[model samples]
Structures are given as C-alpha cells and as structure tokens.
Target: MKKLFYFLFVLGIVSCSTSSDDTLENQQNPTDLEPNKAFVYYMESPKVSSLQPSWYYTFNYKNGRLVKMIGKFVKSENIWSPDNFYSDSFTTLSYHNNKIELKFSNDTYPTIVYTMENDKPKKAELYNQFNELVTVKTYTYESGKIKIYSKTYTLETYYTYYLDSNNNLIKSEKLEKSGGLDKALTTTTYSNFDNSKNPFKKLYLLNDNFYEKSLSNNNYRKINYTIQNLQNPEYLPEIGNAEWTYQYDLNGQIVLHHPL
Candidate 1:
C-alpha cells in the first residue's frame, strides 16, 4: 500500500497540496522587494487550539528541501480516510548555499539524516547510525526567522516572519516538537495578503504558549480570530470570538470554508 500511503504521508493525519517554489505565488507583491530577497514560508501543526481552527501540516522550503504539500478534507459520516491525507514534500537536501542536508523518509522507512550549518546554526550536529554525534542544535537567524535550541533534547524551535513591502511570504510562524514527554503537539501560524479588499494583519503566538491566532482581511468576507491569555493577572475573562467564511473562485481558489 506504498507503505500505507507513506505512513499516511509522514503522519500528517491527512490534508495535502503540492506545488512548490516556496509559496508566495498569486502574482506576488510584498511591497516590491529588496530586504535580502525575502521569500520564505513554512509551517506544520499536529494540533493545539485555544479555541478553534488550528490545523496546519505544511511544507515548502526552497533552496533547502521539503518541496510542497497542501491538501485538506475531513468529512466523517461522508466517509473519507486515507489516514486523512496530509503530507508535504521535499525532505532531502535540495540546496544550502551556506550548507544544508536533510533526508527523512516514510513509505520505504529507515531513512533519517539532518545536517545544517549556514554560518554557526547554533553550532549544530545530529548524526547517528554510526555517523556518531547523536543530537545537538542551538540555532538562530533573525529578520528572516529561525530559532532552535535543544537543551540536550528538551527541545525549543521556532520560525517566524511576515512581510509585505514586496518581500513576499505574507506570513508564517511555527513552533515545534510536541507529544508525550512534551505532551500533545503542534503550534501554527500562517498568513497571506494582497488579494486585497483589505490585505493585512496576521498574528500567532500559539505554543510559545500564551495562545493567540489572528488573520484579517478587514472585511472581504471574514477570517477573524482573536484570543489572548498572557498568564492573566487582571486581564479578566469572557474570551470568545471566531469567524471564518470565505469563497474565492475564478482561479484564486479557496472555494468555501465556513464557521461564524
């Protein structure tokens, strides 16, 4: 069964779409460019919502690997299960001007290789299978986004960025490593703009822990969510609000998805 759909497409639980170039295509216009050639967007989520709409299993990393994947469908009584179908691609070294190598497989199984060093990468290292050095990563990259620290595996990871002055990648924020010892998994953040009617505003704090999600279009149709809880001292509570109603055809895609 192709290794059971490649372990349900790398355990995405189902939902995928592929067409890579590291996304940002819809005719792009992030302010007209220059900030070091910005065009980065990546996200993956297992699940963790302070309220609702917290599902993302994404992929697409250009000169690096992880090519593309963006698919979705969850019906149930309507019956749909191939493990759910979420699996993005490009997980084997593609390009790393500074230095990059990554290989991880599922369907055929037994494959894992990760190596990254683009100027200090938190002084990284993770090699096993007799290659030696087990694990280590203490990375950092600003402006373009990337933060990783592995206090001997306690794990701490991040990728955050949102641009519009023509830098592209309207938005993306992802914090990783969840489940069991970490208890449950997934934190997500992704945003986009320019199909204007409004075209701006994107926020996500998620498993960095305070819990937050926001995506705005001013009006155009509605995709709004605002949640907060910074450990509340006097922030008081009544918290509740959600909206998702969109439809865009004529090639722009996004057919329909409602919740209001």
Candidate 2:
C-alpha cells in the first residue's frame, strides 16, 4: 500500500505543488551561465542527504519531444550506504496531435495526458488504470511565471510560479484546499540560482509543471517549506530544507547537484 501510494504521488494525484529556493551567489557568471543545448545524462546520489525534495530524473527526447524520463532517488533523510538502498522509476512519453501521454513503466493505467497548443502545455489529465479517478491540472503562463491549478475529487491545489528573467524558477508557492479555499497547507520558497544552463532546460518544451525535477533555465539553490495542516502545532514535523551547489560541464551547463 505504501508503494502504491508512492506511485500515485508521483503521478501528481496525491499532491501537486511547485518548488522554489533562496540564493547564495552563484559561482558562475550570468553570461557564463548560458547553457548549451543538452540532455541530462546522469545524477549522482550522495552517500548522505536529507534534502526534502530529493528525486532526480534524466530525460530523453526525440524530434523535440520527450521520449522517456527515468528517476533516481534515495530514501528521504536516509544515510545511504551499502547497507541502505535506493530505487529508480521511469515514465515513457508518446506524442499525439496537440497532446502527449506519459505512461508508467509496464502499466496502462495511471498515465498523464498533456494537452498542448502552440507547443505550450495547457492542461494535463491523470487517469487511473480503472479510470475510476481523474486528476486534472490546468496551466496559465506569463512572461516570468507559471500558474497551475490541480483538482481531484478530494482536494485542489493552486500553484504560483515566480521566475527569473531567463524564465528560471525564482520562487514557487502552492495552496492546497480540501473543503474550500481558505488557508494554505504549506508554502514553498526557493532561492539561490546559478547562472549555468539547466541540464533539463529543453524540458520546458514538454512541460514545467513539476516541482521536484524543475525545468527552469537555472539550477535551484535551496528549497524551504512549512506544513500547516496539522491540528497539533506541537506535533508538526520539522520539515527540513534543501540547498544545492552545482558542478558545470564544458558547455557551461549544470552537470550535477551537491546538496549543502
């Protein structure tokens, strides 16, 4: 049941929120940060990491369309070693006219059908294998931001993206509601951006709706969010923050992320 929920969570069914971070000075110059056209090749898993939003994905595209996205992730807040373990998952993308479908590995149900017009994603729908539940997400894009509204039978999530001039995510705010909109369950903020070209910059052509593996022009420096859904304030978990430093490839693109 835990694994079942985890799979559903990744499908943007259980939760759909964007990400942001605070910045420290980037080691690379703004001009030098101009990234080359590139594809994500790999992600290094640190032996110890407590990053809140932790999974990383490497994507493949053909004819300017996404073909596949493979995820590599460790247990949250775990000290990974020979004794501990990690896992991976992947989704395959198939494009149709004005729409693209992302299917899980070896599954027909639990897929995301993305609708695009003029190559910009307008809506996405997630269907269970039984087709019993449909989770829908609608998008609105502006010069420096992206807004997403997601709805399921039980809840709704509103996402506001604040971006840099280069269209990199500067901050991400999300509001979740169960009965009706009132207060947010959490607020996420991102800071610190390196000028290096994002490894997955081309992914913006597909979509920028996900928070964990961002499709921004630059790399996220940090992620901090506080949960507000708890009834007992004293029992609320201490949600940790994620901060990143990066390594650059030859073409001035981010090659790897080091959590600080």
Which of the numbered candidates is closest to the native, going by highest TM-score?
Answer: 2
To one decimal, what is the Cα RMSD in angstroms of model 1 from the true structure? Answer: 20.5
Task: Write the residue-wise lDDT of candidate 1 on 1-260 in tens digits.
Answer: 99998998776733334233323221223432111110011111222112234333333434332333233322234333322333342234333333333443332222223333432323445555455555565556666444555433454444454433444333444444433133222233334333532212111111121112222332222122223332343554333322333455474533322232
**Candidate 1 TM-score, true structure as reference:** 0.20
- After TM-score superposition, what is the CA distance of residue 148 in candidate 2 from its true location, in Å? 0.9
lDDT of each: 0.34, 0.57
Q: Which stretches of candidate 1 lie over 4 Å from their true place?
A: 1-141, 144-162, 166-243, 246-260
TM-score for each candidate, following the candidate numbering: 0.20, 0.64
Q: Following a full C-alpha superposition, what root-mean-square deviation does model 2 have from the true structure?
A: 15.7
Position 184, candidate 2: lDDT: 53
Top lDDT prediction, candidate number: 2
Task: Summing lDDT over every window of 10 consecutive residues in candidate 1, give the lowest-scoring window.
Answer: 33-42
